[model samples]
Target: MKFNVLNLIFAIVLITNCDIAFSQKLAVIQIEDLYLTSPPIENKKTSISYLVEPSDNIVIQYYTCILNDEFSTCKSDDLLSSGETEDYSISVSIPKDLAGKYLSYCISAISKSGAYLPSENECRSELITNGDIDNKNALFSYLNQTKNFSLYNAPITDAKDDVSFVTSNSAALSLSSEGDASLIGYGSEVTNAPNLPKAKEVYSMLDGFAIKSESDDAIIWGQFDTTPSYINQVEEIFPAPYAMAAILKDGGINTAGDMVRGGSISSEAQKRIDKLLSKDGLPKAIYHTAQAFLAVFDMPSGKQKLVAWGQSIYGGTLPDEMKSALSIKDIVTSQDSFTVLDNDGNAYSWGHSPFEQHQNIQTVYATRYAFAGITTSGKVKAWGDSYYGGLLSSAAIDFTNTNPITRLCASDASFVAISDGNKGVAAWGNDYGAGYIPSNIQTELDATTITDDFHCASTEKAIALYDSSHLFVWGDKKYGGALPSNIPTFSIANVIGNNHAFLMKAMDDVYAWGGLNQGGCIPDGHQCLSSDDSSLNLRSAINDLSDISQIGSFNTFSEFEEEVVGGFYVRGSGAVVMWGNSVPDGVFNE
Candidate 1:
């Protein structure tokens, strides 16, 4: 046997070299693409990414743990090799008062030849309060220092960084400047950026105040404390001798030096007659007459008297030949008669129908018992008591044809007209709907104009005016024609009566809407006279009127009681207002 067969081949080569040094002293470490590029430090700034693989004589270490609440690991961080397969980046700055929670990381590889590597922990991440951090601690610190690594439980890929840190102070990390810094392409450190103002200019610059009229977009200003008690109830219900003799006889000024050189009175009418004579003063038995070249002021206990024939009818109480033959230039009245139009328009009347409705009358309209007139070729007349239908009896007219009338209105039994080439509108007698002339308004008969309301129960809805000044109404909307939603379509020019519907406006500006009781509407300052109202509760009480230049209306009565029958009238330097109920105060202070 050759030495016992060589001792079994040297014991099989020392048992195969002790199984190759125990399989090279047990080694295994792998980590790959671990990532986290900002986003996960609840109280703010963070970034972490890595990749490594080391096995042969390995050594890779990165560890951090702060677990507690029974999750155990109190706090750690040290073994950080960061060498093999090294690809790492880390930044963590969390502060907003860093409240706790679990956070663990591990990737240990050591095998430089004295090998004993088996540590690739990583799956514990969760520092959550705001959540973020999972790329398995940067891909297990990159395949635990990768060698010929093969890992299965892989997870660690989260990268989305538009660079954010809005304060938990890492120097306040937020760079997305101007216009969001060109939408994150970054390039804006600040340029012209100072904003925050308009809340009415920051409350008018914190109340140092200065915003008067940036063009007065008026939210509201002043002037309306019930407007001087509605202008002292329109000067105590349209007085001033029936509104200055219905504006010098309907403002065409028939005489009395055209109501004292009529420039249409209104520079606030001498400050509204010196504020109503300094608040109810003047007026008492002021007489200066010479054959009725009158100037009597009375009224304050003296029953009633305000007779002044034109120019200063004695406010200075004169008698110098009755102030030089009644230097009166105009004065007319009717509730029983009194007239004067001297200044050469010469006309006068006494009392009691003195010539029937005051013959030769320029305008007038009484009614305690009847009277009416209109002439100067506009023809219309009426007398008293035809049993309260007054008088305009052409056998109660059914239109036997007759024109040439340019306005005339009566109510309380009917009468209306606005003739001249059938500009349409006609009516007559005893309330057959007042004067019943509407076959659909005779096919719009060129409807030049028309108006009347006799307190209107239905004068075919009374209220009309056309020739394109359009303003049509049909029968008593409780008094006049209602209409007023903010009135814009304009175009009326003239139409009076005011228990409600007044309307003037070719810039003469007047406009009253309807109802205050049969007076129909006026009530804001009151005005409008001369147009039908012997009684209809005296036209509801009148309302609203302002600086007019002129206006008129009437139906009958003329033997010149200074005239007014089918009524209407207006004029406005200062006064001359009327609205039915038969105006008379010597046709306004004469």
Candidate 2:
């Protein structure tokens, strides 16, 4: 390496004499106490920390050159401000790429007046090879200390290194609540995302997660193509069982993942399509179901327009009245028909025996094969396949003056309505589904003394009830209608259900029941039950249930709506915990 000593000397004299013209005193700027904070390491940033006098307006100029590369020259292109110090010391990061090479570095301070700080040029001159291993036997000495635990019964030994555990191939690492670390059996190598910020919000789609950062960046992991979409700030995401769409901050619409034929796309094409929607207007909201996707946009003409895609039951054509409606109040769907309620109290239905004419509709509910509407006067009307709750039975209509129906919910094949006064609940639709309230639950409902705060959820064949104090479930036992026999008592705070399973967050823990590989199972390390039937207490595995802010299923269901694939638990800290099947069975996005 060559140095322009004569030039530096000339520049220093000029700055020194110029400073005397103003301050009438020569500046005593100098770099002091320079040293490497740690030994240089391969493939890792090496820090050099130092303390300096009179830190203001000082710039740190650092130069490095590989020791044996005769063609290499030292360069000081990067300058760090002296004001950016920590704990009375400033640090400089040495590039991690200098592995297996001896390196020489020089650090000096320069004042704003262009005067160089006097320091020992011989300091940090010794040649040291960046931490590079030449022998396989020495690799263990560089490994991070790990606990003697492995998920696959492989032997584990504690190593002495203090760095993060490194994996060369497909090895997976799992950390326990106790901080015990284990390596899962190797499969494929995982690469970390470059410069990803901390996650702020996350949402789950059919088989992956959409993560939003505090910086407003949105990224996806699991089941997405490798190419990045480079999304703008995401405002909201609407995820359906089979497909998903999102609205950007600029009101541009982006859609991805899961198609009618079970395909998916990355955000690339979605960005191109965003131009099409941008010409119309910004989307106020987007909605999706297993069969189709829809968006409502505020047009430039001061009117709202609706767009639909995929195999919609309406066959890409909306009703004339719906197209001209001033504004849509709500839109809902059953298995074969889609319903829309307009702001003017008119309701429209199309596909699979659409209801003729409905007016003054306050609310609407649906089972797979039926639709029920409650008019402003509180009268309930039903239509579609009578056997699947298209028509209410006489018993279901018997609302007394004291016990009036308050709310309605549905399983895949049935409708359930709960009354206000005595907590009475009535059901109609397929018998084996939630259509018939069990006699035991009916007795409990009739005997209920409290009249408020009842929450309910349902799967394909069962309904779960959380009455302020107790949880009651009824329907088909095989599909999570009944609580698992070994589960602890329920003071359930919340409950979520996909088609085949139910997940409940209770006072002490979270629990699930149904098909083991579906939403019923938590991830391996967090399982509530051990192979020996000992209680692991899932909340302990998760640290605490209260940290979780929301829970939901991917909502993947079988063709007959008999099984759920997986679910997600979103923590208040913006970390999402996903369980069940993560990979789609077929080539969904290919």
Candidate 3:
């Protein structure tokens, strides 16, 4: 029975008296799958997103009350807050007074005919509130304790103000409703630009690269750089060696680079792009090399396909049949070519096929001018410019016969293949670049007994590793080929090397030895080792060493030549350290 009801009490009454006569009749509505998106917090807004069946003319009624005990009774007048909604979601303000106490909430839906779910009278949900998470560190701790560490897994947006929040260890980043981004925390600053959108999702790398998607995509590092004016919507951003490429929502590509421009897209590829745009295709994934971009698209026909385009300076393009997503499993690129390994382990070359067909390929590695692969059977092969490690040496063949290659690492012009158990090692490439291992080092490689913790790092001049209490260096001596007599031997956690220097992070301290100007020497005050002695100190100019997570390398331009010269250390606490001969010239504090 239905009557024009002006209050919730009458609605409840109508629901209770099912047999009562009314002026008009309506069907009862049902609601299911009721659940809370997240726990309510004290002095904070709690959002409840809901979807109910027979959505039309449905109303959501909710109320919250502080509970005294498990058996406490809640009266209608005891409701601390109450609200009604016709939309799918609602946010309620949890009062500060409720902190440290349990709160019960009742959420139900009723149809226009006064029919409701949950019959009447009982609250099915109770939650304890944690006092306000007003700071980034506290918020992260709460998320960690609750095991909901991914803060941005779901979009968090304030509809009325259009503000979004992004958190890092040191600060909270907010995009205001006015499209201004402000960093709030220790040493906080604001970059005022009336251009940023209320981001739905923002992706960031510790090296100061960030991009916010969902609307009018823009790049934010230390400063704001909006996407190309022609791009209406951005799906993803791919940072390549010398350029940045963005896949557009319309299946088109936009790029900012020295040699390649989105406007210069090939006519043939453009036609395919237009077809996808017309059908509203979706961008799936993207891969890029210095010279080319490969995009995967989900088409309207329910087929996943690939498209490739670039300068093609070295003949890089996918085969017609290989354009089908199923035909390719992985892709590796050399400076001028692309090698696609099919699912069956057969390899195909598009840009420069300098080698014969290879099968059963487990993995492939590349140098600037050559390619090498290790077969599933542990056999190794190489091809391309013989001068640049393209031709497998007799030593490689002999070494593999006794012990199959377990892994491979490369320098600009050399390849180092470590045999199984790391008991043996071999190299080939330009002789000056450490392509030929000295006989004495080979003897050491044979005698050294390696544990499961074996690690190898390579650079243009040498490879370094821990052997007992002494760090061994082998290769060209000009850079790091010779071990420094003053360097102490310690258990190393990780080691990384660039063109001319190496940084070793020991269990508690970090050590460096190589070209001083190229990052081999730790700047004064930055060392974890005190100036008086080699003892480890928790604090230094480099921050806390015990919390360091990993070290990464980045490319920097000096004297008009691009070189991978800098090392950035990311700490477990989200603090980052950038060190090297040259750091990018810009405000990186953001």
Number of backbone collisions per candidate, in order? Answer: 101, 1, 0
Model 3, stretches more than 4 Å misplaced?
A: 1-210, 213-216, 220-232, 248-254, 259-264, 273-283, 297-305, 314-316, 319-326, 352-356, 449-452, 465-472, 525-539, 543-546, 556-575, 584-590
lDDT of each: 0.31, 0.50, 0.51
Candidate 1 residue-wise lDDT, 248-362, digit = tens: 1111111111123221233333343344344442422111111112222212342222333422321212223222222222343322334433322234434333332133333
Give candidate 3's whole-model lDDT. Answer: 0.51
Residue pair clashes in candidate 2:
170-188
Q: Model 1, poorest ten-residue lDDT window?
A: 201-210
lDDT, residue 489, candidate 3: 66
Global Cα lDDT for candidate 1: 0.31
Please identify model 1 stretches exceeding 4 Å from their true place.
1-296, 299-302, 311-391, 395-436, 439-590
| lDDT (tens digit, per residue) of candidate 3 on 1-590 | 34211244336645554443252354444443343344556787766555566787776777666665422444565556767778776666777766545565555666655453322322333344553221111111101100111110111112111224432222335444455555433211133223445555443221123345456675544222323222347765654333345676655776543335222356677676677667776666555444566566666664456666775654335567555544344556655666655545677665555434577674677665677777654567887778767897888778765555645666556677765344767788877767777888778877865433455566654667553354666666655676677666666566666556666666566667666555566645445232333442323535543355544333211111134344323233334444444431111232
Evaluated with TM-score, which candidate comes out highest?
Answer: 3
